[model samples]
Target: MDGDLVVDGNITDVDDGAAALIVLGNLRARNIYLAGDAKLVVHGHVTAETFVGDMTDKLVMIHGDLRATVSIFWNEFCPDLVAGTLHGRTLAPAYLDLSTAPIGCLADPAPEAPLSRLLAPELLVTGAPGPDDLTEIGIRGDALRDRLLGGLPLTTTP
Candidate 1:
């Protein structure tokens, strides 16, 4: 994009053939979901509620700071380069390359579970929620993950 991009909802890339994106300015979004091979580069800062990068060969490079409530990198091959500071909770594979280590952040190594398993339903409902909200519903983790991986929206009207 030529200038700053603001997304009210989410930015999801599930297609394997998705095109690469280059943002000249900052990017503000609710969430970012990447499960494709396309590369994403942001020259300016990136502000989001959550960022989920599943199994993919994409490289995400941010020239400026990245501020989010939660950032999850599920695959070791997914390389994320952040030139500036990173602020938030980061759940990533130990081998993943995040150029700059986060500051005063809670970093967690992703478990053997799928990407969706790390995301709680409350996150989709509310931008940020308490950790205990994960079990507030009756759905199993695996089941929820499967549904999410299958392209089902977590929060939708019947």
Candidate 2:
């Protein structure tokens, strides 16, 4: 895989080549291993099992989950990291920065914490189902989404 291996679809395997895997679109694959100075450059979401190799600079901005051996750049793309996990020794530099990144709160099956607890108490938030009361919750959700998308810092306090 070299000279811009652009894939508009999914890539089953990319471990055989020592070139850069540049995905122009989404990459829905598993077990991606690169060797001999291989690189990965994805312009879209990449859902994979594991990525083994030293990722180069071109490999920036991933919108999905990546359980690689390391995670260095998790904020170069959108802040809203839907679901993903970066593992390995290459994530030390970005560890502290992840706290402010969207990837920091990525919950797959939903966390054990209650949703109401995540919002401000002054927002009059609740988990119960009411007639017009539910509208307030919806508004809060919208606000949160807007803040996240706008890359604005969220206030967790009441």
Candidate 3:
């Protein structure tokens, strides 16, 4: 049933059970998600954006081909990730400006990311530190997304 959909703003498809939303185009919204086993596939770029409840949302790179220059966050004063394979500039780790709402990632490592992708590219921690646990957030756009999306080759530094 070609159930995939592409949109540009505030995507909400909680109606369907366990659905996948493909963002092949540009999108900007305060919140975007699917209610049932929902997964978000970011294709291009997301700038000055935010997403809530990404931990349980099953976020991952649908096709390893495409890369994004988007900066998205779960909270205002949280570390925003410029998700993509390219490198050059870095997202500010100290997001004190987002004082209104504690960024989801800033609180604790997202447990879903067992692979620890959040600490891989960078680590942004808030408040005092003492054996804290934060779930890992990730741009699971591995080599798979690159081939499917037919995007530029990714470069990772070790």
Which number leads on lDDT? 1
Give the lDDT ranking, best first: 1, 2, 3
User: Where is model 1 more than 4 Å wrong at Cα?
Assistant: 95-158
Cα RMSD (Å) between model 3 and the true structure? 15.3
Candidate 1: which pairs clash? none
lDDT winner, 2 or 3: 2
Q: How accurate locally is residue 1 in candidate 2, as Cα lDDT from 0 to 100?
A: 23
Best by TM-score: 1
How far is 40's C-alpha from truth in model 1 (Å)? Answer: 0.8
1-158, model 1: which lDDT tens digit per residue? 99999987677776576688789999997677777585789999888866666666777888887776656666443435677766766655555545444332223333334334545543332434444223232333343344445545443221
TM accuracy, model 3: 0.30
Candidate 3 — which residues are off by over 4 angstroms? 1-9, 13-17, 33-36, 62-158
Give candidates' CA RMSD values in order.
8.8, 16.3, 15.3
Relative to the true structure, how large is the alpha-carbon lDDT of every model? Answer: 0.60, 0.37, 0.33
> How many backbone clashes does every candidate have?
0, 3, 16
TM-score result, candidate 1:
0.62
lDDT of 3 by residue, 42-95 (tens): 555433222322223344442322122223232222222224332112222244
| Model 2 steric clash pairs | 65-84, 69-87, 69-88
